[model samples]
Target: MSFKSAFTLTSLFAVTLSVAAPARAQTTFVDRPAELRSGTCASPGEVVTSLANLVITAGDPQGQLGATPVEQSGTVVPFAISDFLAADHAVVVQQSALESTVVVACGEIGGALNPDGTLAVGMRGMSESGLSGVAYFTPIDTFQNTLVTILLVGDGGTTTVAVVDTTVAAGDTAMAGDDTTVVAETGAAPR
Candidate 1:
């Protein structure tokens, strides 16, 4: 074959290969917004210990979703915050001192995500522990990851007021006791 013809043939073959070859796959990224949900717990002082474990569960009736350990500082769990927004979802904290069996604090996961994609709820103390606090669920990524934050406060003391004697004459009233004020002296629980 002539060198010119051979060159032309080779050039055509190369162009055909290039055209037939598949294009590189283009990566696609989805915009999954972050989400958050928070709940409050009982006063930290009411908890027997500072150490506890946080669990995310199906809360309407309080079913276990999975066991995830979380310290007072906070911990990341393998879950999407939006999935737990159902009325039946809940976050609970069990006292480590009791082998994590005693529920010292709990909060139901509910409400819509805020404009910034966050949810907040109250955590009430269990077993009359008088504990109270808030939990904040924040999405760490677009995938299944959420940062659970639990903040608990001590029991706020109670106040007692003296009773006024109503048995006195219709025109006069008398104080039967003194006023007493009590402040909670318990220390704040670690979160």
Candidate 2:
């Protein structure tokens, strides 16, 4: 081959290899789905109020990832799981009644990621709020976006209740106390 043609071909091959190399490397980590890491928060001391806003941050309370409103029962937070587990993280729940400055509840993110890419952590309430709960981190998508579910319950003689449906067909001869309360009437069978 002519020198000019040979040089041109070599240049093209080098460029092709350079471009493909990064693409291959990118796929190495991309194949693995995002992970989930969670933490729980509670009152540092005695205080009143179960409603608050939840935030995920890099251990520091100021380094926030995202914030979402949380109810007494629970709430869902949308954040990238990989980013959450990248470093030491914390879940902070601030009381809305006190202008959200009071860190009513907080939990440090720890523990190894499960085989299914899920993690759970415990939280403590700030002050004497008598609030505590478990934070469950779950992967909702392949892109690493996690749906953080925070379930909070009072500490003082408060029982966390979950309603389950045990409805059975009439005359099916099922066990006793099989009544079910339909929270919503979607006209669809429970999956």
Top candidate on lDDT is 1
Local accuracy of candidate 1 as per-residue lDDT tens digits, 68-91: 212233555556666565324556
The TM-score of predicted model 1 comes to 0.43
Local error of candidate 2 at residue 184 (angstroms): 25
The candidate 1 region of ten consecutive residues with least summed lDDT is: 26-35
Please report, in order, the local distance difference test score of every candidate based on alpha carbons. Answer: 0.45, 0.44
User: How many residue-pair clashes does candidate 1 contain?
Assistant: 21
TM-scores of the candidates in the order shown = 0.43, 0.43
What lDDT tens digits, residue by residue, belong to model 2 across residues 109-163? 6677778888787766665656677777677657444555565555643222222
